[model samples]
Target: MINPHKQQIIKPKKAVIKWLLDSDPAIRWQVMRDLTKEPDEFIVAERKRVATEGWVAQLLALQDADGKWGGVIFPAKWASTFYALLLLRDMGLEPTSEQARKAVSLVRHKVTWGQEHGNSPFFEGEVEPCINGRVLALGAYFGGASDQLVDRLLSEQLEDGGWNCEAPPSRRSSFNTTICVLDGLLAYENAKGACTAVTDARLRGQEYLLVRGMFRRLSTGEVIDRSWLRFSFPPTWHYDVLRGLDYLRSARVEPDEQVIEAVDLVAKKQHQNGRWPLQNPHLDQVNFAMEGPAATASRWNTLRALRVLDWYYR
Candidate 1:
């Protein structure tokens, strides 16, 4: 009773695997769990190293007296302490780590999404979808079930199957906002294990990305925006073709013919030396380096693009 038409997924190149293994321990642990289906001795050793000497340690060392690492609660609302913790979760920081625990407590006690304080267990008020999404990501990363932010995120999803931070006030969906919401939703689903609404939201969001061919209008076939084509580091939450497609590939969703054009666009960027460039970086202050912002082919961008293309070609 088995169907045999399904194509086998492409395994990452040996060099890629080695590169991942040789990267930071936190990244290595994530690649081992997300990209590799099996955990052997090598993976176990890498995870242990992550526990002992990863960015989590560096971040933990910076925590302030009030349990907030960045000296303020929800500092800027977009890319603040709340946002950083969300990204750290996606980076595969252990939820039980003291750093993560402190962040969770700080946000829970000191932040409010809306006007009322103590009105709801989740941040109260006119919550932005992307903000809710980030909080959902934090809760899910820490294995905190019964966190209702997941429901709030879904409620704010725009009609185009994406999200917009300005949607509540302006009622307009935006490419950048949609992408951040998608990333947060993916992290949430990965942590929750099973959720039908989350699954549907993710698929619809993917379709939105695909409908635009990752960076173009379906009707005009014109680039969506100059910014859409540019790649960036720390992403700081933006929608670029590279970031969006990278998400699709990580989710292991099958790429159809529609996605090939985008895949090809990304592949063409590889230099003769077989690496991708860093292109540009989002303007923000951050603690670490995920990539280099120069003409040289960056290791981070290269690894991400190669993995996606490899999956597509297979």
Candidate 2:
């Protein structure tokens, strides 16, 4: 029988579809490919823009002579360098572009994060889970990923079925870090179904998010963090409930009762006008405006929330 809980998921509205299509070409590409039905030509045209004038160009402009986005191996901010590249790949940036080629060359030259390299850059040679996750994603994009990197990511999976950035030092599993890893793994899984290690690691990581109701505490039943409620644009590395839920739904995970709590949380935020607001922004040198931070309705956040809600409720 069709689950009664599933009845709540709704058919996506035209406004929501248009909004998703109109937003980031990278996200649009994900939605376009995942839609139960194929989107019209208009959506395809927008995805093509990634190649024409969007992030592919933006990231290219940010590149330095060394071929990395930020001059350092891993910028002080862990998410920006590799995670940002994954965002561009998600948008459908062609790997063959000159900028992409340069970026790939730079990544290959610096670190032994993947198997193509001769030795581990560090004495331990074991990379942090998040780093391996992003490197796996980069390799997936350029068809250069090796079994070694996938093995590293799989080995790092924590007891909770998620990943933790503070592996040897902190040791506490984290929500944000787990999502970032999942994002990269899912991208790799979709691109090439060849690697079982990445596939298993991703499945467990996804279970962790779902067990927490995507945004709430498993035992306490409280919202995990205030920041989880805030929606952000270009979600650098921070994991809001909105991004987590969207990722789950996009990956076609079955929604259980645990997801209902998250669904309720997101639903309450939608305004009477059927929109969500941008609660945060990436602290970057350049960004596009979405009204202001909190006052106006954010077209991007609304599109993401509504689509996720629609899929789950149906």
Candidate 3:
């Protein structure tokens, strides 16, 4: 029997659907598959456009000869190879495509973690759980991640049901670090099938967020961080309400009462014109500006917000 909550359909507002359909292939394909539910062939054809056109193409064209973007392999700056790959993953670049294969190969052969760690492989990951979590996601999707990488993440799970980049020093888990790891684990499951350990770890990480209503402090019932309420694209390593809720939506966890406040917050952000605005993003040296500074209507946020609503309020 179909699970009603899991399968509920929320037809987007007609104007919103039309607006989303008129954007980049990266956004348009997802709109069709997730929002409009277009025929499979239509969805497949649209998804293919991402490899050779739009932002994927723009970012791929920026790749340096050394398989890095913005002249570095990985760095604190947002324009580096790490972020470019993260953005491409979010854009839904077809993993099987020849174009994607070539772009990823460059990084596979050239990118490394630098001399500090004796030049660790890109997919093998670095010390920080936040960075390793993202590497696991990218590796699982574009190619595959090593078992050591996966097991390392699983072992890092905090007693509180999440992970913290500052675990030994700070026993508490962090929203940002936890979200990154959860996303990686989900992608790993999707790519290589699940394990009991992975599933259990994921559930615990999710509960950590759910118990806090995804935004407020568990103890004081006060907002944990106001920045979490705002939405952004390429979210980098930050965790916002929309990004966190969208992760829950992708995992298809049953919409529970715990998520009500966060879901409502997302709904209230939609403008009367059936759109959502991009909020102030973490400023970084990005290769290019995808949209105007906060307050502009954001196609990425609108698509994600609408699909999240579809998953939640059924």
Could you say which candidate leads in lDDT?
A: 3
lDDT of 1 by residue, 1-314 (tens): 12111122244456656765676777776566556745577767666565457565665565555545465436553235665665566566656766556666766676554344343444332366655665565666666633466677778887878888887666656778777777767877787676898889878878888887788876798887887666765566567887888888778888787776777677667665555688767546565555555665566676676667656765
- What do the candidate models score in CA lDDT, each in turn? 0.65, 0.66, 0.87
Candidate 3 lDDT = 0.87
* Ranking of candidates on lDDT, top first: 3, 2, 1
Q: Which residue pairs clash within candidate 2?
A: 8-313, 9-313, 9-314, 10-314, 26-91
Query: lDDT of model 3 at residue 157?
Result: 92
Candidate 2 error regions (>4 Å) = 1-43, 76-80, 96-103, 109-126, 169-172, 194-197, 284-291
Off by over 4 Å in 1: 1-22, 30-38, 76-79, 97-99, 102-126, 145-147, 168-172
* Estimated TM-score for each candidate: 0.80, 0.77, 0.95
Q: Which lDDT value does model 3 have at 276?
A: 89
Question: Candidate 2: global Cα-lDDT?
Answer: 0.66
Q: What's the lDDT for residue 102 in model 2?
A: 69
Among residues 3 or more apart in sequence or in different chains, the pairs in candidate 3 whose N, CA or C atoms overlap within 3 Å are: none
Tens-digit per-residue lDDT, 42-96, candidate 2: 5666556666575556665666665555544445342345545666665567687
| Stretches of model 3 off by over 4 angstroms after superposition | 1-9
Best by TM-score: 3
